[model samples]
Target: MPPTATPESSFSETAVFGDPVAQQLLPLTNGRFAIQTVHGFAIYDEADLMTVAQSIPVEPPGWPNSTLSASAEHLVWRDKNGRLFVQRLADEATLDEAILLEVPGNPNGWDHPSFHLSPQGNFGWLFDGEAYSDEPPVVTLYRLQDGAELVQFRGGLPQFTSDEAFFVRDTAEGLLIYDTTRLTEPLYTVPRDEEISIWDIDLTADWLQITKYLRAEKRPFVELRDVATGELLHTHVMADDETRVTPSPDGQSLAVTFKQDDGADSPTVVAAGVRLYTVSGELRHEFLAPQISPVPIPSACAGVWTSRRSDPVYSLVSVDFAPDGRSLNVTYNDYVATPVTHLYATDSGEKLAEFTGHESLFVANGRSFISLSTDGLVQQWDTATPDATPQTIARYGTPITDLALSNNGELAALVNETGAELRRTADGELIQQYAGATAVTFDPDDQTIVLGFVDGRIQWRSLADDSLLSEMSDYAAPIRRLAYWPNQPEPTVLALAENDCRVTRWQLATGRQLEPLHTILTFDEYGDVIQMSIDDFTLSPTGNLLAGRSWFMYGFGVWDLSNDSNILTELEDQPLGVRDLAFSADGRLLATGEAWPLGGWVGPERGGLRLWQIDEDNVSLRWSTELDQFVGAVAFSNNSSLLAVGYSSGDVTLVNTHLEQFVGRLETVSGVTGLAFAADGRLLAATTRDGLTHIWQTGSP
Candidate 1:
């Protein structure tokens, strides 16, 4: 019987919850700062840390310092295709249209290209070349107001003056200064000594600060020179371990991060703190904090060492002067402790305030806000009470690899490399955790939970008391998938290994192993028969049919589990790869999603979702729709009336099975990793790669 078409329904997003990976915190004008996240930039007022505006581009930019840059007025970035984007900041809109500029020449050979925004946001510069090439790198300067190239040159690193009147480029001979109005020739050249190599350069209105490494002494030093005359004013020789010299905005003082050497015969080097100094080499103050103990180092020389400091040694990640130069912001590495940002007086060295740098966002009940941060702390703020403090929920040292929701929506299973955990969905409370777990799933009754381990073992444990019910250890490879069969006499579980081409079945009730089922076989390019391994798999509702997607063969196949016979096989001859497949509830329809072979970011040439009609012995294509993004996941509704397709571009589409038309579409902040529908078909859930899980209501319009 043909499945009925799903009625027209209104899909509304309910809640989105997750922490975005924060890339960097950039200080802007007027005590304002911007947090560069994976999605885009979030500007906040530093006084109260309130969000002023959010600037998300049409296509999210790459990581900061690589392909993304921002100023107070504009944001510049590069897409995956090396096309530069310039967006203007606006007070009314969170997202603004950006002008896309396709860079000339093929960027395929470019290595580690980066973008830089001018201090005033009027210009953008792109640095592209081979990382270790002998030739000089290419630098292209663009006028931000319009996508126009002003000049293109070959230089190592380009630094723009604060006033934007002139810019300097580091070259083999010296620093070549150029007037912004005319780039025909260098205005002046600051010559360098043969033994000195520039590591970093900061240009200001009156002075130029350069960090240079002395080859003879094997030490680094900071040099302050006159910007107009190109004459060295003062030079400060840093300690053997000191680095990262950042000049103040006014170019009067400099902040240097240094490591302290323990006074032993074979001294251990540890990052002590930042040192504030004037350009004339006058020490202002030492901004020292508690340090984290360094890891034990293996050395040939041994000496008796006694510590004078009682606090653990911690490393300083970065030190930045405030826009006004009155205070300094110090950040510490978060490996040994919670990440903290400390503000200190420049002259007095008085500690002002400490912040976790975690932004507290209050989103509307049904509206979605996407964020990503590097920190592992997770907290939930009460939207009902505006001034209430947030409650800390859970802290994860490692990133979440996979997530699954129970049938009743009461429990959520999260998997990482080290273990799998079950948390209550109501308040995000941890219930149980299993170490060495790779994958996890729940039974239909929600009473028994099945877990797959990296050691090729499967455990079926009771959810009520967290007791082991059954265990199987037949395979020698890591288990990747664990699913329970429905409508079976015994509670049977199927397990797929990461390196095997067969699926092993185990009966949980009697703890007995069933016969393994092999996937389809196909002919290779050399005309030899080869067994295709499944990269993704799905089972029919009745457990009588199974579908497997072969990533290597760029095809998918269906097999009759009752007879262990391959019933249908389809292969694409192009460079398209089948990503996911799902079987309808009635076992009469199948849906498969495909995408380009090269990560799906290379222009949308080929990829989409296809629906196939499955008969007793034959399968026919019902309809196919081409998409602009890679399809990451697909699932069928409980009644097989609606098919939900998820894409790498964070788009989720609901399609009517019988009509072959789209019912609704939803967008997320990142690529969708998993998709599922509730048993009653009233709710749909989608998990994104950025650690966010979104839930939506499926109801009549």
Candidate 2:
């Protein structure tokens, strides 16, 4: 039998729960059966355990940060928008009745809503439910009954003495509870407010648990306390935060899963590593799980849990943890918005090894290209004979944007909200700093750096001495994209405005503005021109052809540069509508990526990727291929024999032109922004959204 490609059998195990998961319950519920899987949420139904609900048709942008909560009445959760929702499994088509649970005028902002539902349908709790003391440890609590406001409180609630009362939230100072038998005050009070976050509480038994958290130390501790007598029953400190702590069916030992850090940008909390902790604060046994870390880095306190037997860490993007937590689920870097690294192991807290195989876009030598992932560092590849191992260049604190490479490829410039930094590619050292730069590029002469802003302004600086090259341009709108003609001798530049569909060409030396070329709109409603490249401004390749994407309509075509009209047939309504546009090295073909589509707005895998055999002779599509995944970027190696495709899922596939078969596959990277083939045709460089770059080489030429 052919080998089956099942999810990590052990670490990525699917636990059969009672009901189907409602993934739409963002932030509050972990979405259906399997919460937050790469493709979508794994939902389960009460009928058959193995059968799971598939992800929704639409894909969300960026890494998904979700929280899940399961209640008998409904499943709830939140998405990146911080919106709260409830999902009912009865009818799959009903998507209404979502409530915005964010409170009015909460200082903590709407992003952090302390929402928790009780399994007993008592009341829900929001905020701290205490009077605002205007201090570091002020606690306020809001009570909810049947999803409606029930009561609000300042300080601690009145203590309860009945067996039907149960605590919902706890702090060092006190505990909040649901009083089945109404009492004027059914809350218990502790002495202080600092040292604890109540993970669970049982008011009837006069028992509560304070989960201790230390961020810098990456450790999580728990203490069992007697609420009635303020007695510390037992204190247990674990190596890291416990991804899940579920009391055994008999309530003797707590099945605990410690969150281990996998070296990926964002690690998922996984099970495979399980421990049984006695309620008396005793360690019964810790199942030694396999190690999955690529390196021996300590855990950074990130983890999650599905059951007492299953614990996994969640990542920003997507990840796969192996069964035993020993072998790695081949790390797919930049596989999604933020990249996810997964470690396979049996123990939830086992150290797992991970490798990142993705690249980022950066600036070098006044040219912008994708960087290859060489080890953990970023490197740059020259288009000329680009086969060499991209020389190791700079290291960014996180990812970088608006990188400006000097003409000689010696110095680099980059920016983020914190400001901009210019560094040397050779030694990865900082050269200068600037404020508020959105776009960075090098001048054609490699003598200066250009800085574009969000406020419709552009600035330049001389590279030789880091002096101001020219006064900033006071354009009408933010410069969305900037490109310098590839082979131009003088310092000429193209500026894209965010406010309108206009491409402005400016000659730096003469300050001469040519009549805006290709300003006429092809579609009634203007389309977003994702990217624009210049080869020979004379339109020699395809007879006055200008290639780009149109707004609302994702289409790829060559337009008559003189008239701004479509030359070849246009492609429209594709999900990822022209994330990137590339002309084959021979200029006989054009490729467009289906990645970076305006997700959350549309769904229809419309050609995941398509290659048009440029009928330059007739100016039409000769032939094309239908891709399956969302293509983020595309490139044709110099010889045009191999087509490199980078996908939003971080999967990179190299396909042969003649047979259109897969030639090679690289590690999954985040959304690929740009692709550049080396001059030698043997290497490919891919740039990702995470601000890292990578170089890919193959054994076969």
Highest-scoring model, lDDT: 1
* Residue 204 lDDT (model 1): 80
For residues 1-701, write the lDDT of model 1, one tens digit per residue.
Answer: 01123436877777765555455555555444555555666565533443345455435444332323435666665554445555555555444344435443222223556567887677888777764568888888888777588889887566788878888988878889888888888889877888878888888877788888899999988888877777888898897767688888788888888777676785654447788889888988887656553323112112211112223555545776655677676776543344565657676888755555343222212111111123443344332342355544334233456666788877778775457878765555678989889888888989999998977889999999999988888765567777788878999988877646677788987779888776643545567555556645788878888887664525777778777454554443322477778888899998988876333344323467888889887778888887655687888988998999877656687888887888767777556777888767777778776666777777732
Give the alpha-carbon lDDT of every model: 0.67, 0.45
Model 2 agreement with the true structure over 1-701: per-residue lDDT tens digits: 00112211111111111111122222112222333322234444323433444443113322232333333334444443334443433344355543425443222122244455443324444544323334333233323333555555543333332232544434334554444444346445554335434444333345555565555665666666665455677676765445555443233445465545544665544433445566776776564333333211112111311001111322222222221222222222321222333333322434233324443232222221233232233344443434445555333333343444454445555554335667654444667877656666665567677777756677666877877666546464455566664545567666655434445667766666665654322332265343322211112222344565544333444554445443444444333355666677566776666543223344323335566665543444444555534566677766777777776545567767776566566643244555555444544455455444454443334
- TM-score of every candidate: 0.56, 0.41
